[model samples]
Target: MSAIGGPCDRALWYGFRWASPKRFDAATLKRFADGHQTEAVAIARLKACDQLEVYDLSPDTGRQFGFEDHHGHFRGHMDGVILGLLQAPKTWHVLEIKAVSDAKFRELEKAVEKVGEKLALREWSETYYAQAVLYMDYADLDRHYCVVCTPGCRRWMAVRTERDKPEAGRLRGRAQTIIASDSPPPRISEAPDYYQCRWCDHAPVCHQGEQALSHCRTCLHSTPVEGGEWHCARWARKISVEEQREGCPAHLYIPGLVPGEQVDAGPDWVEYRLPDGSVWRDGGAAYTIGDTIEAEAYRHAA
Candidate 1:
C-alpha cells in the first residue's frame, strides 16, 4: 500500500522483486518496537474515550483489521476501525495509528492551521496519506482517522481524511501496472546522487549496475501468479515465500542485471563476459552464487 503510491516506481519495483534483503540498524529496529508500543497505548486511550467505539482487533478472527488485493500481493493491516464517534455515530472509519517526533507533531499542528489536517497530511508525509487513502478504499469506508502520537506516546493528535475515489482508482491501476511489469519502470532520477536515488537501498543495483541479491523473486525464471503465489519457470511449481528467499541451484539472473556481456547461453545456463575478459556462467550446474562451499570456492572464478 505504501510503496504502490510512492513517487518512485523503479524503487518500488526493485523492492517488490526482492532486489535486496531488507536490513535495519539497531536504532531502526528499536524505533519499530517503539511504534508497536505506541499503537497499544493509542488503542487503550481510544477505548477509554466514552464516545468512540474502537475495535482494534476483530471479534471473529481475533486479529487486527487486514485487507488484501491483487492476488494478495498488495495488502495492509489497519490499526483498527472506529465507530460511534461524536461526529459520526453510525458510520465506520478506517483507523491508522502512527508515532511521529515532537517536531513532526508540531509540523502537523502548523499544517492543520494552514490547510486543515486532512489536506495537511500530504505535507506531513505522502506515505502516510497514501496508506490512509488505500485503507479507506479497502475497508469500504468514506473516511479515515489517523492518530499521530509523539515518540514516547506522550501526546497524540487526530486527523480526518475523506475518500478520493479517483485517486484510489489511479493507485489501483498503478499497482497493477507495477506488478505486471517484467522490468523496472523509468527511474525517478537517473543520476546516482539524485536526492531520491542517493538514499534508496536499491541504488547499488539500479544505478551502480551491481547484481541484486540472489533470490527467486530476483531471478528471471520467477513470476508472480494467482493466489498470492510465485511460480518459477525453471521449476514449474508454485514456490512458497521461504522457498523464494532461498533460491535453488538453477537460479538464473535476469539478463539486465548481469552487468556483463552475454557471449553464450543454454537451457538452465547463461554465460557472460566480464569487463576484464573473464568468463562467468550461472545456472545449469554453473558458478551459482548460492550459499555453498562450491560458490565460495568459485567466488572469484569469473
Candidate 2:
C-alpha cells in the first residue's frame, strides 16, 4: 500500500536486492564487480581443498531452477548454483563461495537454505538432492555444506536441519486456505515472537521493530543482581509513554533500503548511507559506559 518505499519497507528491498546477482552488478561499479575474480579464487580454493569436485548447475545443463516467469505469473529461479556443485558417493552439496566473515557466513547460510528450498519444490526434488540435499520434507543427508572464503579467512559450515513440524503444517494449511478461498493466509489468534519475527516478510503489520525490544538480549535497564541470574524478566519492561515522548533514536531513524544503496558493517558499527541521508548504529548499549555516553549521544543525534 505504501508503494513498497518507506523506512519500514527497506527490509523488503534489502531482502530481494542483494540476493540477485543482476542487482549487485547494476548497483556496483565495473571495478567493484569482482564476482568473476571471486569465482576464480573460489575455484582454486576448492581445488586445493580436495574435498569436493565442482560443476556449474546452469540451465544449459538441461535443468531448470531459480526464478522463472511461469505462464503469465512470475515464479522464482532456484537452480543457479553459485559455486562448486559437488558430489561424494551419494552425498550432494551446493557450495557457495563468499568473502567469509561472521556476518557473511550467516547471510550466505540463510540465502542457500531459502533458495535451495525453492528449487527443490519447483524443480525435481531428486535433481536438487543430487546437487544439494534440500530440507523440503526431511533431513536425510549427513552434510549440507556451503564454503565461505574471505581474503584471509576461509570457513565452511553444514546446514543444520530443523524438525519444524508445526511450521510445515502451517505452510500446508496456508496452501489449502488459498486454494479454497482465493485469499492470502488467515489472521491467527496469536502472533509470532520477535526472534522468529525477522524472517516474516509481513512483520510490519504488528510494529515488529518496536516489538523487538522485548527480545533484546542486552538492555541497560536490566538489573544485574547475582553471580548467575536470568535477567530477562527484569529487563522486559515494555516501551513506556515517557520513552516514546522522549523520541527513542531507534524509532525515529531506520536506514531502509533505497533502490540503489549499499550497506557496510565495520568492526565497531554498521553504517547505511544513501544520497539523501545516513545512519550509524553504536556498537551496543552493553559496551557504552560513563563519558563514552556523550559520543553515543552525538552519534545518534540527527
Candidate 3:
C-alpha cells in the first residue's frame, strides 16, 4: 500500500500477475506485512545513526520524482515514506528504505530503460542504485542512503560521490522534463531481448511473443565462459530463485528465537522464486523448522 521509489515492487507484482494470479495470494499480504516490518526495522536503525532525519519529502517538494526508466516512469511508483532526509550546511541526503526480496530486485534491475518508455528488465539492486542516483540528482543532494531490511537481516549503506558525476545529473534532468510533458512519447516497435514482451505488462496487448526469461542472447557479452566465475558478478546472481525460496537456503530456522529477535543466521544460498512463479531448483543445503519456532527473535517482534 505504501509507495516506495524503487521499481522492484511493481515489477514483482506484475510478474506475479503474469506468472500466476495466485502469486498474489496469502503470501502477498505476508510480504506486505513483512515490508512494513522491514521499514520499522530500518527506521530504528536510522535513529541509531548520529545524523539522519526521517521525514516526508513528498508533501513539501510538491512533485513526485519517479525512476526515469520504463517501469519507474510509466509502470511503477516509488514506495516507502522517505525514511529520512539528511540536511546539513548546504548539503542534503535522501534516505529510501526497501523491504524487497532478491527476485524483485532482479526484475527492477531489468526494468530500467529510457524515460517514458515501456518497461524492461534488469537486476534490481543495480536499478535501485540507478534510481537512487537519479534521486540524488533530483534533490540536488550530494549523497544517498539505502537501508535494506529483509525478514531476519538488516543492511545499510551510504553511497557517496565526490561530485554529481556526469550521467547522474543529466539523466535526472532529461527524465524530469519528459515526465512533465503533456503528451506521452511514442512506443518502440520492438524492444531488446531483455526488455521483450513476455515480461512486459504491455505484452498481453503487444503480444510480441518474446519469452520472459533469459534475455542474454542479445547481449553483447553473450559468450559463455565455461568454468568461468567472476566474484563481482556473483552478487547479481545471488538473488536467483534457487537462492530465495520459502523453505530454501539463506533463511535459517533459529529455534527458540522469538520472531522479533535480531539474529544473524549467517549467509547461505537459498532458493529464489522466479518472475514466472516457478521455484528455482537448488541441490544445496536445506533448512527446517523445529518445535521451537518463536516470533520474538526477528528484528521486529510483535
* Every candidate's lDDT: 0.82, 0.35, 0.39
Candidate ranking under lDDT, highest first, comes to 1, 3, 2
Which run of 10 residues does model 2 get worst, by summed lDDT?
A: 1-10
TM-score of each: 0.89, 0.31, 0.39
Off by more than 4 A, model 3: 1-26, 50-92, 102-126, 152-165, 168-196, 208-302
Error of 3 at 108 (Å): 13
Clashing pairs in 2: 65-78, 65-79, 66-76, 66-77, 66-78, 66-79, 67-76, 67-77, 68-76
Q: Tell me which of candidates 2 and 3 scores higher on lDDT.
A: 3
**Please, what are the lDDT tens digits per residue for candidate 2 over residues 60-112?**
66653332111212122222232233334445443434344467566645765
Between prediction 2 and prediction 3, which has the larger TM-score?
A: 3
Q: Is candidate 1 or candidate 3 better by lDDT?
A: 1
What tens-digit string does per-residue lDDT give for candidate 3 at 148-175? Answer: 5556344333233222457565544444
lDDT of 1: 0.82
Worst 10 residues of 1 by lDDT: 293-302
